[model samples]
Target: MTPDNFIQNQKQQSSTPYPYPYPPPFSGPQPVHFSQYTPPVADSSILSHIMHSISSIDSRLSKLESMDKKLDKFDGLCEAVDSLFTRVKTSESDVKKTHYSISNIKLDELNAEKDNLWIAQASGGSGSPGKGSKLKKEIAEIHKQNSELKSTVSDLNLVIRPSLAHGCAVWLPSSASSQQIL
Candidate 1:
């Protein structure tokens, strides 16, 4: 047979119009053979598997949502803790300031008291004017009185010694005798 006729014969013997083993490349819209086309049948096991996968995905999504809520609560708690920490720091600073102020006040008071005490000691007896001199005058008067009492006692002893040596009753004033007896 001739080559062209042999090629034509080969085309007629094949099912497709194209002489190549693969389908033809892109062309205009072709008529679809719906009569020979079959819709896919639903498989119970495969459908169940897909449903289970979707349910698992939904469950995972729900868990993630719950975790997100928990994270939000945790973030709020963190903020509260941070605020509390700041307040604590503020309180600590205030306390330190108060302590320093109190200590300074106490020191100032102590220094004033020390100065007052030194002044009081320098002037004697509560820093009153002439109070120390008055006490000194009183003490001197007491000493003078004590010396006079001693002289009088020595005179009495002189009078009593002779009478006791004679072993006789000495003439004495009643007051002197009473003083001697005492």
Candidate 2:
């Protein structure tokens, strides 16, 4: 049969509509079976359903990608907070250590001053009359200086101890220190 007759017979035999004008061209002289031909049927509902499913899956994938980005940002924020917390703790510890060291040094100085006062008092009584008066004046000046030092230390403790307890750093200028003393 001719190609046109074969195409017509295939069209007549199959109930479904053919997309192409005729079947694929063959190179060899093969016997054509038009009666046995079955045209492909495209169901619109099934195609639409598949397209919808693909779109929904694409949207879901996009959402998952965005959530992953948010999680990464949250992780970075957590690390920053942890780093800041560690730094604050270290600074607090250093401040406390420095305060203790200063207190110890001040106490040592006071003790030394007290010992010197005792020595001066002991020698003052045995000195010559003129020298004894001079020693008294010197001893009185030393006592005044010691009292001033004690007051200054007390003021520093008052300002610093509360700030330390609250985990705050306190810086007092020379002017501010004088104002606080008053």
Candidate 3:
């Protein structure tokens, strides 16, 4: 083929799916017996075989690219599934029970703090004010911590667990007891 015709054919061939660092069309493997004046029939057969090999290589390259994309998505899905499993397992750790215990502790501390304040006011002692104020602040901090913990526990129960389940994946925890680390 003339150079002009070869260039035009290459342009058309490039529009199809091909891997990066595309192969040069006219720069195919050279024939071993270039010095020999080969017969036209032999030349034609060799050209056909080379074309077939190039086509096969292109097909395999396309398949590999597609598989690579699919494997990336699979990896992302696996990571999401793993994180969901961890959250679900964490939610089952009696968080609600822990929150309840913390609430009780906060309430008892608050009552004690109030009683100390009242005693300080009734007795008119300068020494009791510092202890009473410190107790009150500690109680307030404990209450705040308890509030955050409860909110976190509730959100895990009401939101995260259901949302994960809705995504068509089942994040199952191991049946082993909680004392064992996985």
By lDDT, the best candidate is 1
lDDT of all predictions = 0.80, 0.79, 0.73
Candidate numbers, best lDDT first, in rank order: 1, 2, 3
lDDT of 1 at 128: 56
Off by over 4 Å in 2: 1-39, 120-182
Screening candidate 2 with a backbone cut-off below 3 angstroms (N, C-alpha, C), the clashing residue pairs are: none
lDDT (10s digit) by residue, model 3, range 33-145: 66654655668889999999999999999999999999999999999999999998888677887899999999999999888768885554464756666777788899999
Misplaced by over 4 Å in model 1 are 1-38, 127-182
RMSD of each: 10.6, 27.6, 38.7
lDDT of 2 by residue, 82-169 (tens): 9999999999999999999999999999999878766665576443445656778888999999997888778888888887778766
Model 3 collision count: 0
- Whole-structure CA lDDT of model 3: 0.73
Clashes (candidate 1)? 0
| Per-residue lDDT of model 1, residues 111-177, tens digit only | 9988886677555666656766676788789999999778767877888787787776655454343
